[model samples]
Target: MTLNWQCIVVDCDDPRQLAAWWAELLGWRLTHAGDDESVLEPAEGSPQDGVSPDMLFVKVPEGKAAKNRLHMDLRPDDQAAEVARAEALGATRVDLGRPDDASWVTMADPEGNEFCILRAFTPEELATLE
Candidate 1:
Protein backbone atom coordinates (compact mmCIF):
# COMPACT_ATOMS: atom_id res chain seq x y z
CA MET A 1 0.00 0.00 0.00
CA THR A 2 1.14 3.53 -0.66
CA LEU A 3 1.46 6.04 2.13
CA ASN A 4 0.05 9.54 2.25
CA TRP A 5 1.81 12.60 3.60
CA GLN A 6 0.25 14.25 6.60
CA CYS A 7 1.15 17.18 8.77
CA ILE A 8 4.21 19.43 8.94
CA VAL A 9 5.05 20.19 12.55
CA VAL A 10 7.02 23.37 13.08
CA ASP A 11 8.80 24.01 16.32
CA CYS A 12 8.48 27.58 17.49
CA ASP A 13 8.53 29.67 20.66
CA ASP A 14 4.98 30.90 20.16
CA PRO A 15 2.80 28.44 18.33
CA ARG A 16 -0.24 30.68 18.37
CA GLN A 17 1.48 33.63 16.79
CA LEU A 18 3.24 31.56 14.16
CA ALA A 19 0.14 29.55 13.42
CA ALA A 20 -1.90 32.71 13.10
CA TRP A 21 0.58 34.10 10.64
CA TRP A 22 0.46 30.97 8.55
CA ALA A 23 -3.33 30.83 8.66
CA GLU A 24 -3.47 34.40 7.47
CA LEU A 25 -0.94 33.77 4.75
CA LEU A 26 -2.74 30.76 3.39
CA GLY A 27 -6.25 31.97 4.16
CA TRP A 28 -6.76 28.71 6.00
CA ARG A 29 -8.52 27.85 9.20
CA LEU A 30 -6.64 27.92 12.50
CA THR A 31 -7.26 25.67 15.45
CA HIS A 32 -5.37 26.17 18.70
CA ALA A 33 -5.07 23.54 21.37
CA GLY A 34 -4.67 24.12 25.12
CA ASP A 35 -1.15 22.72 25.00
CA ASP A 36 0.44 25.62 23.19
CA GLU A 37 0.02 23.88 19.88
CA SER A 38 -1.88 25.04 16.81
CA VAL A 39 -2.99 23.60 13.49
CA LEU A 40 -3.63 25.22 10.13
CA GLU A 41 -5.92 23.47 7.72
CA PRO A 42 -7.88 24.37 4.62
CA ALA A 43 -11.29 25.66 5.41
CA GLU A 44 -14.37 23.69 4.40
CA GLY A 45 -15.36 24.14 0.75
CA SER A 46 -12.10 25.89 0.10
CA PRO A 47 -9.94 24.78 -2.82
CA GLN A 48 -7.82 22.50 -0.68
CA ASP A 49 -10.83 21.58 1.49
CA GLY A 50 -10.00 18.44 3.41
CA VAL A 51 -7.57 17.12 0.80
CA SER A 52 -4.39 18.61 2.26
CA PRO A 53 -2.59 17.75 5.44
CA ASP A 54 -2.68 20.22 8.26
CA MET A 55 0.33 22.36 9.11
CA LEU A 56 1.04 21.99 12.78
CA PHE A 57 2.90 24.24 15.19
CA VAL A 58 4.12 23.36 18.67
CA LYS A 59 5.95 25.38 21.27
CA VAL A 60 9.52 24.48 22.14
CA PRO A 61 12.06 25.87 24.56
CA GLU A 62 14.84 26.62 22.14
CA GLY A 63 14.47 29.39 19.55
CA LYS A 64 15.12 29.22 15.86
CA ALA A 65 18.78 29.87 15.05
CA ALA A 66 19.43 28.14 11.74
CA LYS A 67 17.68 27.76 8.42
CA ASN A 68 15.08 25.08 7.94
CA ARG A 69 16.14 21.81 6.38
CA LEU A 70 12.60 21.35 5.08
CA HIS A 71 10.97 24.47 3.72
CA MET A 72 7.67 25.11 1.95
CA ASP A 73 7.41 26.40 -1.61
CA LEU A 74 4.09 28.04 -2.30
CA ARG A 75 2.86 28.91 -5.80
CA PRO A 76 0.47 31.80 -6.15
CA ASP A 77 -1.38 33.19 -9.13
CA ASP A 78 -0.09 36.64 -8.35
CA GLN A 79 3.35 36.29 -6.87
CA ALA A 80 3.87 39.98 -6.17
CA ALA A 81 0.55 40.37 -4.39
CA GLU A 82 1.11 37.26 -2.35
CA VAL A 83 4.58 38.39 -1.39
CA ALA A 84 3.28 41.78 -0.35
CA ARG A 85 0.45 40.21 1.63
CA ALA A 86 2.87 37.86 3.34
CA GLU A 87 5.10 40.77 4.27
CA ALA A 88 2.13 42.52 5.82
CA LEU A 89 1.60 39.41 7.87
CA GLY A 90 5.12 39.62 9.34
CA ALA A 91 7.06 37.63 6.77
CA THR A 92 10.44 39.00 5.80
CA ARG A 93 12.24 38.54 2.51
CA VAL A 94 15.22 36.21 2.69
CA ASP A 95 18.04 35.80 0.26
CA LEU A 96 18.73 32.15 -0.41
CA GLY A 97 21.22 32.77 -3.17
CA ARG A 98 18.50 32.82 -5.80
CA PRO A 99 19.35 34.45 -9.10
CA ASP A 100 17.88 37.83 -10.01
CA ASP A 101 15.70 36.20 -12.65
CA ALA A 102 14.49 33.40 -10.41
CA SER A 103 10.74 32.89 -10.36
CA TRP A 104 10.62 32.34 -6.62
CA VAL A 105 11.05 34.70 -3.69
CA THR A 106 12.24 33.34 -0.37
CA MET A 107 10.68 34.60 2.81
CA ALA A 108 10.86 33.90 6.50
CA ASP A 109 8.03 33.99 8.94
CA PRO A 110 8.06 36.08 12.08
CA GLU A 111 9.74 33.18 13.89
CA GLY A 112 12.33 32.94 11.12
CA ASN A 113 11.10 29.77 9.47
CA GLU A 114 11.80 29.95 5.76
CA PHE A 115 9.31 29.42 2.94
CA CYS A 116 9.15 30.47 -0.68
CA ILE A 117 6.59 32.25 -2.80
CA LEU A 118 6.73 31.08 -6.38
CA ARG A 119 5.11 32.32 -9.53
CA ALA A 120 2.35 30.09 -10.79
CA PHE A 121 3.60 27.94 -13.58
CA THR A 122 1.79 27.65 -16.86
CA PRO A 123 0.44 24.26 -17.94
CA GLU A 124 3.10 24.05 -20.60
CA GLU A 125 5.85 24.84 -18.14
CA LEU A 126 4.59 22.22 -15.69
CA ALA A 127 4.35 19.63 -18.43
CA THR A 128 7.86 20.46 -19.55
CA LEU A 129 9.13 19.99 -16.01
CA GLU A 130 7.55 16.57 -15.93
Candidate 2:
Protein backbone atom coordinates (compact mmCIF):
# COMPACT_ATOMS: atom_id res chain seq x y z
CA MET A 1 0.00 0.00 0.00
CA THR A 2 1.10 3.49 -0.75
CA LEU A 3 0.05 6.76 0.77
CA ASN A 4 0.02 10.04 -1.10
CA TRP A 5 1.06 13.34 0.46
CA GLN A 6 -1.47 16.09 0.01
CA CYS A 7 -0.30 19.36 1.50
CA ILE A 8 2.17 20.77 4.00
CA VAL A 9 0.20 22.71 6.59
CA VAL A 10 1.74 25.62 8.49
CA ASP A 11 0.39 27.31 11.59
CA CYS A 12 0.51 31.08 11.38
CA ASP A 13 -0.98 34.08 13.12
CA ASP A 14 -2.34 35.38 9.84
CA PRO A 15 -2.99 32.78 7.17
CA ARG A 16 -3.62 35.29 4.42
CA GLN A 17 -0.35 37.13 5.00
CA LEU A 18 1.79 34.01 5.25
CA ALA A 19 0.11 32.46 2.24
CA ALA A 20 0.73 35.61 0.25
CA TRP A 21 4.40 35.65 1.21
CA TRP A 22 4.94 32.02 0.26
CA ALA A 23 2.93 32.36 -2.94
CA GLU A 24 5.15 35.20 -4.07
CA LEU A 25 8.34 33.44 -3.00
CA LEU A 26 7.54 30.26 -4.87
CA GLY A 27 5.66 31.86 -7.73
CA TRP A 28 2.67 29.78 -6.77
CA ARG A 29 -1.00 30.74 -6.99
CA LEU A 30 -3.64 31.04 -4.30
CA THR A 31 -5.97 28.15 -4.81
CA HIS A 32 -8.16 28.24 -1.70
CA ALA A 33 -9.06 31.02 0.68
CA GLY A 34 -11.20 31.19 3.81
CA ASP A 35 -11.62 33.47 6.79
CA ASP A 36 -8.84 31.80 8.74
CA GLU A 37 -7.16 29.56 6.18
CA SER A 38 -5.46 29.77 2.83
CA VAL A 39 -3.80 27.41 0.36
CA LEU A 40 -1.04 28.01 -2.13
CA GLU A 41 -0.70 25.68 -5.09
CA PRO A 42 1.49 25.49 -8.12
CA ALA A 43 0.69 28.01 -10.79
CA GLU A 44 -1.67 27.13 -13.58
CA GLY A 45 0.01 25.36 -16.53
CA SER A 46 2.99 24.60 -14.29
CA PRO A 47 4.57 21.19 -14.72
CA GLN A 48 4.48 20.76 -10.94
CA ASP A 49 0.68 21.06 -10.93
CA GLY A 50 0.20 17.36 -10.26
CA VAL A 51 3.55 16.32 -8.85
CA SER A 52 4.06 18.94 -6.16
CA PRO A 53 1.79 19.19 -3.19
CA ASP A 54 0.02 22.41 -2.20
CA MET A 55 0.81 24.39 0.96
CA LEU A 56 -1.96 25.02 3.47
CA PHE A 57 -1.78 27.94 5.86
CA VAL A 58 -3.90 27.80 9.00
CA LYS A 59 -4.60 30.45 11.62
CA VAL A 60 -3.10 29.79 15.02
CA PRO A 61 -3.20 31.48 18.40
CA GLU A 62 0.31 30.85 19.70
CA GLY A 63 3.60 32.02 18.24
CA LYS A 64 6.48 29.78 17.18
CA ALA A 65 8.98 29.37 19.98
CA ALA A 66 11.71 27.01 18.79
CA LYS A 67 13.18 25.62 15.60
CA ASN A 68 10.88 23.73 13.30
CA ARG A 69 11.39 19.99 13.01
CA LEU A 70 10.44 20.16 9.37
CA HIS A 71 11.31 22.97 7.03
CA MET A 72 11.34 23.66 3.30
CA ASP A 73 14.43 23.79 1.08
CA LEU A 74 13.83 26.03 -1.88
CA ARG A 75 15.93 25.82 -5.05
CA PRO A 76 15.73 28.78 -7.35
CA ASP A 77 16.87 28.72 -10.92
CA ASP A 78 19.04 31.73 -10.18
CA GLN A 79 20.34 31.67 -6.61
CA ALA A 80 21.57 35.29 -6.35
CA ALA A 81 18.53 36.72 -8.02
CA GLU A 82 16.15 34.69 -5.90
CA VAL A 83 17.92 35.69 -2.66
CA ALA A 84 17.56 39.35 -3.57
CA ARG A 85 13.95 38.78 -4.52
CA ALA A 86 13.18 37.05 -1.22
CA GLU A 87 14.90 39.82 0.73
CA ALA A 88 12.81 42.43 -1.07
CA LEU A 89 9.72 40.42 -0.13
CA GLY A 90 10.52 40.78 3.61
CA ALA A 91 12.35 37.49 4.31
CA THR A 92 15.38 37.95 6.55
CA ARG A 93 18.50 35.85 6.59
CA VAL A 94 18.77 33.82 9.74
CA ASP A 95 22.40 32.79 9.22
CA LEU A 96 22.33 29.14 10.04
CA GLY A 97 25.96 28.75 8.92
CA ARG A 98 28.47 29.47 6.21
CA PRO A 99 27.08 32.71 4.85
CA ASP A 100 29.80 32.72 2.20
CA ASP A 101 28.79 29.31 0.91
CA ALA A 102 27.37 29.44 -2.60
CA SER A 103 25.41 26.27 -2.07
CA TRP A 104 22.50 27.56 -0.01
CA VAL A 105 21.27 30.42 2.15
CA THR A 106 19.05 30.04 5.18
CA MET A 107 16.20 32.49 5.55
CA ALA A 108 13.14 32.97 7.68
CA ASP A 109 9.68 33.71 6.39
CA PRO A 110 7.52 36.61 7.46
CA GLU A 111 6.06 34.44 10.22
CA GLY A 112 9.49 33.18 11.29
CA ASN A 113 9.51 29.85 9.49
CA GLU A 114 13.08 28.84 8.75
CA PHE A 115 13.67 27.61 5.22
CA CYS A 116 16.73 27.26 3.06
CA ILE A 117 17.41 28.67 -0.37
CA LEU A 118 19.45 26.12 -2.32
CA ARG A 119 21.31 26.81 -5.49
CA ALA A 120 19.97 25.08 -8.58
CA PHE A 121 21.80 21.83 -9.14
CA THR A 122 21.98 19.73 -12.25
CA PRO A 123 21.02 16.08 -12.38
CA GLU A 124 24.68 15.11 -12.39
CA GLU A 125 25.36 17.21 -9.32
CA LEU A 126 22.44 15.68 -7.48
CA ALA A 127 23.58 12.18 -8.36
CA THR A 128 27.11 12.95 -7.28
CA LEU A 129 25.92 14.21 -3.91
CA GLU A 130 23.73 11.18 -3.42
lDDT winner: 2
Would you give me the overall lDDT of model 2? 0.89
Looking at candidate 1, the ten consecutive residues that score lowest on lDDT are 27-36
On a 0 to 100 scale, what is the lDDT of residue 76 in model 2? 76
Give the residue spans of candidate 2 off by over 4 A.
97-102, 122-130
Worst 10 residues of 2 by lDDT: 94-103
Question: What's model 2's TM-score?
Answer: 0.88
Give per-candidate clash totals.
0, 0
Per-prediction TM-score, please?
A: 0.88, 0.88
Candidate 1 Cα errors over 4 Å, as ranges? 123-130
Please list the C-alpha lDDT of all candidates, in the order they appear: 0.88, 0.89
List model 2 lDDT by residue over 1-130, tens digit each.
9999999999999998899889988989998877699999999889899789999999988999988789999877788899899999999988655547458898899989999888888889779978
